[model samples]
Target: MKRIMRALRRCLAVTAVLAAAFSLPATDAFASPTAPASPTPVVGGKRAAQGEFPFMVRLSMGCGGALYTQQIVLTAAHCVDGSGANTSITATGGVVDLQSSSAIKVKSTKVLQAPGYNGKGKDWALIKLAKPINQPTLKIATTTAYNSGTFTIAGWGATREGGGQQRYLNKATVPFVNDADCKKAYGDDLVPGDEICAGYLDQGGVDTCQGDSGGPMFRMDDAGAWIQVGIVSWGNGCAEPGYPGVYSEVSTFAAAIAQAASNL
Candidate 1:
């Protein structure tokens, strides 16, 4: 009985460590051996139903994205930095469950990483689909609406830290943290203009974890339409107190996003 108890304790310890390192892709560029993990989807959230978030997309490269237009997808820059015309990237949408057959898959024709994206802020990318999808696209947040409020984030990332990717989409609501408080949390790691912070300071057990990178952090507009305010970028650990998840601030680069989308 003593040996069995010891084995159980070790398993619990491993689970805790895995939960702490929550980034989705687990790449060297975004995470170091000493740095807290970054990326992925909701931790402590409920599963989403089909068509709940119509714009949510699952990337073949282990990230989440949002459909900006019929032919364009907005995702994290790190997910497409080295990917080009030859890369076989696919974006699956229109389904909540990854295993469902109702998904709409589109191949990428080109990938455009934001200018000067190097695993830091401005961690956004635009993927041009080979064919346009017929679903509705999410509107970008152009004002300071994202500066403060309760935001909803969704993705197909791991349900827990250090776990395998989830088959069903998960959704969570988190409060936005001010830049001042966020700065205190991330210190020199925080990018003010390029990133927005969202999560609970009290460690309320609500946050995006691994496999959710590049997913949408959004809120409803005054008209009740969904507007994307941020893109899942990085964080210290999943749902850790004082360390809210950082996202690419959509308002900061709305013009750039428009230009890139228009050109394509």
Candidate 2:
């Protein structure tokens, strides 16, 4: 709940730095790879327990995702290439520690990226596993009702800016930032209704950084069920002042994601 965090996009990190240093326009980049890549870790977060987040998934290509169904994973569209047959991606779940013996691994058979994702907004995606994962699936929010307030974010991304990934899962909490304020910080880069912002805007600290891309931004519902509201998308830096972390507003694309999952 109290830590440094940022969106995990290796290329985006570099792009953000350049944009800041040179006063150039920001660009969004895909964080995942076509081949097997190292996973990233979360910084300044509390280590998660063995099964605290059963739906949490570690993508081989340096991102995170959530199990949407027995054989479907909901992630960021940028975490994968355009939706189609994809046999190179892998998903690991059921354990907080990447090296834990009880971890479950599954290969991906296909991917369904958002229909109109062009390196910008509409950054949600669905991945189909080769086989069903014997674990609980996470519930996703369908309306903007869950988009506000404090939310829980977890991942195996870097523990600090430009630091190495972690072996165990990290969990933290961040407050929601309104669109006006978010737009003031990101300008045209902040896509209203398509993206949600969360982090410490004033003091800076606590965010999901590089490697946490495609991960879920979730919170409990009134009935005590966890509902995912956003997907880690991009940010200027890891917990930098005035630049809150950006996420794909799941509510805006819930219907499309559901339809995509059914086809997958």
Candidate 3:
């Protein structure tokens, strides 16, 4: 019984660390929200039609991203945290289903995390492709305030906690939650400048899940073009009550993103 208990304790400790490091699984920690499940996909999202989100990309490392440019992709820092230029990470996009032959696959040649990313916050990252992809890129949110509107997040992540990765992309519409309400839900875990929270406050049916990390939380602009406002970061659980999904606020790093892309 002692050996069994020890093993269980160790497993729990590891789980807690992983939850803090990325969007994998949930734990009871105050700031350490769950990370997406390994090889799993989004939760409580509906099937997305092809060409609906042309900028969506699936990271080979079980995360999601948006095509920012011909060669630049935007995702969460945790998704490529310790990875480098030769990490064998592939960016697959331009298709709704993973099995489709129309999907464009590109190898990531470089990975750059935002400065001061400490695993807990500032979760955005930029990936450089080996070659340029010709598909339309998603615009970053600048003048718009994504703080209080219905936004769409799509990924090939788990549909439920501890589930497998989705074969096709899944999308969910989540309402923005104010900072005070979000802080009430996450307490010290909420980083106001770096993170934004969104989901149902009363019920718990819609959110991003495992393998959804680094995906885009976007909205249509006045001209009807999709603008990425957030990058899936972490949360307490998959659409759990009171705990909305947290994302890296794109507006907070808009200038940084432009500078980084320009330098590269």
* Per-candidate TM-score against the hidden true structure: 0.83, 0.85, 0.83
Q: Which residue segments of model 3 deviate by more than 4 Å?
A: 1-41
Candidate 2 lDDT tens digits, 148-201: 889999987765566445557889889999999999998887789999999889
Residue clash pairs of candidate 1: 23-38, 24-211, 40-209, 40-210, 40-211, 40-212, 40-213, 41-209, 41-212
Q: RMSD to native for every prediction?
A: 10.1, 8.7, 8.6
Lowest summed lDDT window (length 10), candidate 2: 24-33
Name the lDDT value of residue 68 in candidate 2: 95
Candidate 3's residue-wise lDDT over 169-239, tens digit each?
87879999988999998787778988888999889788887678888999888888888888888877677
- Decoy 2 TM-score against native: 0.85
Candidate 1 structure quality by residue, lDDT tens digits, 1-264: 332221121111233433443333444212232432333336778768778898899887678899999889998876665545734788889888665678788899998899887656787889999998788899998877656789999987765555556667879899989899999977767789898999999755778876788899999898999999999877765777877888889999999999989986
Instruction: Please give the CA lDDT of all the candidate structures.
Output: 0.76, 0.78, 0.75
Any idea what lDDT model 2 has? 0.78
- The residue-level lDDT of candidate 2 at 242 comes to 92
Candidate No. with top TM-score: 2
